[model samples]
Target: MEKTVCELFAGVGGFRCGLNSIKDKDFSLLSETWKTVWFNQWEPGKKNQWAYDCYVKHFGTSLDLNGDDTTNVDISIVDKNAIPNHNLLVGGFPCQDYSVARSLNGEKGIEGKKGVLWWSIWDILKIKKPPFVLLENVDRLLLSPSKQRGRDFGIILSCFYNEDYFVEWRVVNAAEYGEVQRRRRTFIFAYKKNTNFAKSLNLENNNSLISEVLEKKSFFAKCFPIEKLDVFSIRKTTISGDLADISDNFSFDFANSGIMFEGSVYTAKTYPVITKSRTIGEILESKRVAEKYFISNDKLYFTNSDSTHSDETKTELSSEAKKTWQYIKGAKRKYRTASNGHKYIYSEGAIPMVDEWDKPARTMLTSEGSFNRSTHIVRDLLNNKIRILTPKETERIQGFPDDWTATGMPEKFRYFCMGNALVVSLVSRMEKILDKIFSEE
Candidate 1:
């Protein structure tokens, strides 16, 4: 049976591409097995809709429905039945404060402003009940909102528990597993209660749930292998209560990795298996790249106004960009005063002037093309010039094909999509696991 998928928060079809890829011998890209039935992509407060345009350009738009906005809680503008039923649901929803408080009616629970999008997903899940769900988020989601450390994640678990789903999660770093970037993200995989995988969670020793999840036979532990876990610290703990109470007092010590089954969550620390890594240089494009992409010495300034340079007003790098490499890559301590009456010391470290080709590149941010401090600068070994990474290079770092975002869209938007996307190779590995489980069924 061909598995159908619906992608929420789909950015340039990264999940779709991985799930569908079917390569021939010699590992060249070929075809796909999985099918995407419907997908939703909307950027709030934007008129251009470049992301959506690029997505539609790459994968033809779905005409099965008139409205597909998940945030429309009312569902009046859109018809629920318009969505095709599928076996899988996948997405990398935005990270936000996931606070759940008692409803004003005092009879129901509601999520925080940004967290309301979750309810949109739940709305579809209740109706469609896809057998499998795959989601991705930042590593910090494990411990969010300093005041209430694990409250957000606790609420997420409770929602799945209420729906009778068993979930396994891991914080995976692409570089650790031989990918091109050092991006770390938390991935969540869930199985409905009646499925074979969920049924197997009915273990003889619930106290050793964490160990069971880390076992060789477990799905995640197999795909992304991990070292032994300290079972005592993270086995068979329950976070139970009305959503409101859990919000007020959730555990502050949520583990980095875990599984939730039958209302109980088992969590522990897990490390990745060391593997070969690809560096920034390996993914660079030279001959095809235009000369304008190269950075000249004069273009490195932070300000266009005629003001004396200070730590606050200087460029990301100095006029002598190459000479400032050390200052850009070293740590410094400085005393400063705030705009108000407060006085304090502000100190921070610097990133490399030129990204190291021997190691994986750092995390790509939305401001990829801008002259921001976090932006990557690489030395063109061929021409002996320094320049920022082009959008195409950014795409390669995330395991996407060259010009994947090129559809008459602006260069900045292309970089933005790659910044928000996951490494496609990571999803490709998960696709194999999904196939194995489905075949067993």
Candidate 2:
């Protein structure tokens, strides 16, 4: 079997870059071993489609080896059968309510808008039945929809159970595993029961299977090492029933790490085996940064109080901008009136005015370079000047090549793409285990 891949939600091709070891700034080389047969990228309600444009600019508008088109349309509207079959499927899908309901004909159907994407993935599984699947999502998937905790993830496990696949997941903090950022995400790796690797495991005995697959031999265990599991920390349960039933009634306390096989779930809290971590100071651009990135101390008055001015003339942060950031990051307790005419006290704690260079960076969000409190503000070590991180620095923090998203998008969107991206080195580490599995075939 060839090492073919079908990438879904391919935002600027993070997984592709990692799989092919695309270190060159020009992205000129292609991988001979792992081939991406097809990919789809689409952002709803956006006219520019910057991410899709950047993707096509890097990898040309050519068809895959299987003669399938690299699509930019909404995946929910795409025909599942039209997608080419491949050995592996990978994506970082959005987190949403995974509730299900019975349609007019008594058939199970998706209930919400964003939840439809997961069913699109399920539709592909039902049609193609790919041998392997690797997905990424926010760690909050384990406990979502405040009314009913863990229902969303339980439904996901039940879907895989119905499809005859074994699932293993881990919530990884990149900083804890020697990465540059402190981002935490849930990674799921699933394989079909009929695969050669599944046959090698002791699947009949639950204890033996757990010890072999979840503790030692699984892909996640090999790539991200963890401490030995204490017997009392482990929680086991079985997920049963159709999608609608699971959606309405199923709930479990899913730990940060776990496995699901033949509807049996065994979860536990596992700590990473610490490695040498890289700090924010390590990934800074060695070159001199442009003046626009530096914050200006000059006091400038504006007619309106809105910090985010549409005026392009105001490129650098003014003294007023610094004050706004300080006020947002500072502690505050105030009385406010609700829409119902009730009074209440709102309080929040303070965050450090400047980010520490000695530690890994805080998780980068989509609003990375904005005037928000979560945006990273670092002092340039070379010139000793306060500034926001450059787009190249953000890419380096996420382990992508410099100017990877600099193809044609605006500077703001460039930050948005890196904030949405995953740590490329994490995917690279998992490729080794994927290689071994494919070689067994």
Candidate 3:
């Protein structure tokens, strides 16, 4: 079996970087076991296209590989038939409302702008029928759109089922699996039923199949070990309908881990086999960060209340900025008015003013540098100052190389890329299992 890959929604090559174990700043060397034949990355409504530029800087454009037009175009407009055939398809597609509707010609069609990207993936599956697929998304995909709890995921399972594939998924928190960040994402691993590994599984009995796959047999189970399966916690359901039908009415309490085969879904909550995770202090920069990252003394101190009026006013401006951040992070209970002219009380709990050093950092958000509750602020032991995480530190949090996104992009976007990236080590851990599966053929 060939180990060619087609990377979709390739955000700064996170999937590619992980698969190839690219620790260096550039892609001068790649893994001999797996090769990426094609990739696509495009950010709509953005002129600069920083992510695509960063990707091209590391890995050359599609035109450089196979004479294809470009890898930096909107995937929705690209023809699926143009994609090269490959043994593996991998990506971290955006999470969106995956509702479906019947077209005017009575064919099932995806509804909404972002939801179409899922169909773009389905289109490739229908056309190329890759032997394997590995994908990542926010953990919320298991239960999306409050009105229809699990409809979105159910539709995805149905699509794979129709294509004669078996899927095993797990919601893994990187921190739980010995990574620095506490980011949680859903990982979907699917293989064609006719594949060598799939045939080896005991698929005749759904009960045994679920237990074996979730506990011992599946690649996900092998890489990220789970606690012993308890039969009572398993939930079984049959997904038997078209995409539109499933979208219109399909809801199940899909657990954090599960398998889907031949339309039969067996899902159950499974705990990770915990390991010691690296702490925020361990990944922080050894050298002192730029002065701009540090909170100035004016911002850190409160203006003296007994000072002269002009002096107090001058100092208050900078001091108020720090106070606002404290107030945002602190508990709040206040009265407010709604848009409909209804008076109400809005309450919120406080979060830590400074992130803990000994523990793995909280999930890094796209707004890491901003003065918000979600941003990570820590006491820089080297400089003896409070500061936001630099771009390199953010990269380390997500298991990327020191300056993976520092290739000519703006500093702020570097944080956004890491916030959107997967833990590279997570994919690196699965490489051996994937290699074994491929070699079996």
Candidate 4:
């Protein structure tokens, strides 16, 4: 008594995350069929998206794509009874080329690979012709135009029209809806032309979720006004903190050394060298907090008052610890710096943190890349401890349940999957919608 849904370009189930009881669907037979077809490399430029591999890793039960054991063939290959009978279809198509962030200045049309992915979704819709379809993409898509016609979006208008569907749309921001980050995207809802329903829902409706989701927190929480917030000159500053005592050797500073964000230096006062540095190993206990690590900031402050040095026997630091510090000082001098990112858009600002400890991950990109070089470094404003977020932690950030991708896949592979996944919280609402729709059926 439930509606059937097939997610295309499904990255970690954002479209379906909100739907309860994925167990109700037999997902494996669907995966086997999908794997044989979608993952094949024969088609010209038709291969699985990198994140699709991760999607496959998290299998639904014996349930095929539709959660039905009996109806498991590809839609194009199905007969009348074998095909799923459902009132709705849902998906969030790829949006790289059509994203507002990508085209802040202007938009080129749908020639980009991400733009082309929509055609595949269209192909499925044309073949199956479900009564209703729900889809989402970046707002930039509404404005993409070709010189001949006013906009490529007109093509979408025509596509739905030809399919005998009535289309409606609204622009919504995730931050306004429920997410912490201010992410605005466009959602288009299409229904069979002339179909009867309850009270008519129109385009630009359902904007209540914004306030409903984020009421109290963002209301009184003052946004850090970028214009008014003080910006410091990019002065070349050395990593500072109470360096670990001499007896422990150079290991104390290895993960801790790095440039702190502008004002982070003084704000985080140092705990005692004896107490704080000793506590770090416990803080970094991989098992207790395998997904998090202490990242040191650039500014190192000395808390060792009247602290003696190795050169001077009166120095508080043990001779061995002083010797280790010198090695790091020597290593820092030898370290070669590298460029931040691609020449064009990267110049606007250093890359945002692609990964973080304990917190959810930053957005992922499809590019074959390493995030370590990105602006991923972090210094806890309260504690100067720091390190690059491990790949597993990145998975946690993207809302991939801890270690789901790690147990079976390579760490880099998991990182790629997390990098391409949608924020779980964003997709989680969809799961609830799917459940309500199915329950009524």
> What ranking of all candidate models by lDDT puts the best one first?
3, 2, 1, 4
Please report, as a residue range, the 10-residue window in candidate 3 with the lowest summed lDDT: 305-314
Each candidate's lDDT (Cα)? 0.73, 0.81, 0.82, 0.38
Estimate, for each residue in 1-441, the C-alpha lDDT of model 3 and write its tens digit: 888999998988888878878787844754445788889998989999998899888887774234566688888878788788899999998888888777766443545345368888988899999999999999999998778899889989988998999998999999998999888999999999999888877665467557877899888899999888886788899887487789888999899999887888899999989988999999988886888998765544344423222222223234364465455565555566899999886667767767878989998888888877798888897965788889999988887888989889999999888877888989988887888889897
> How many Å off is the CA of 349 in candidate 4?
3.7
Per-candidate TM equals 0.87, 0.91, 0.92, 0.50
Whole-model alpha-carbon lDDT for candidate 2? 0.81
Ranking by TM-score: 3, 2, 1, 4
Segments of candidate 4 deviating more than 4 angstroms: 21-53, 60-85, 96-115, 145-150, 180-184, 194-199, 202-347, 350-362, 366-375, 380-384, 433-441
Worst 10 residues of 2 by lDDT: 305-314
- As for TM-score, the candidate ahead, 3 or 4, is 3
Per-residue accuracy of model 4 over 1-441 as CA lDDT, tens digit each: 335555545555555543332322234444331111111101124253334444555553223344454222232233323334455666676553321112333354223234355555555567777766767676566544332221234445445655666554444443444343234455666666444421132211222321221121110111100111112211121221211111112111111011111111111101111111111122222543332344322211122322222122223444344333122222111122357743331112222332233332233443212423332344433453444545644544444455556545555666666555555554554444434433543
Model 1 lDDT tens row, 215-278: 5556788788877666676645686746767788776567767777777677777777778889
lDDT of 2 by residue, 339-441 (tens): 9999886667777757878988999998888778788988898887778999999998888888889888999999999999999888888888888889997
Model 1: clashing residue pairs?
Answer: 20-32, 22-31
Distance from true location, Cα of 344 in model 3, Å: 1.0
Record all residue pairs in model 3 with backbone atoms less than 3 Å apart, i.e. clashing.
none
Candidate 3 TM-score, C-alpha based: 0.92
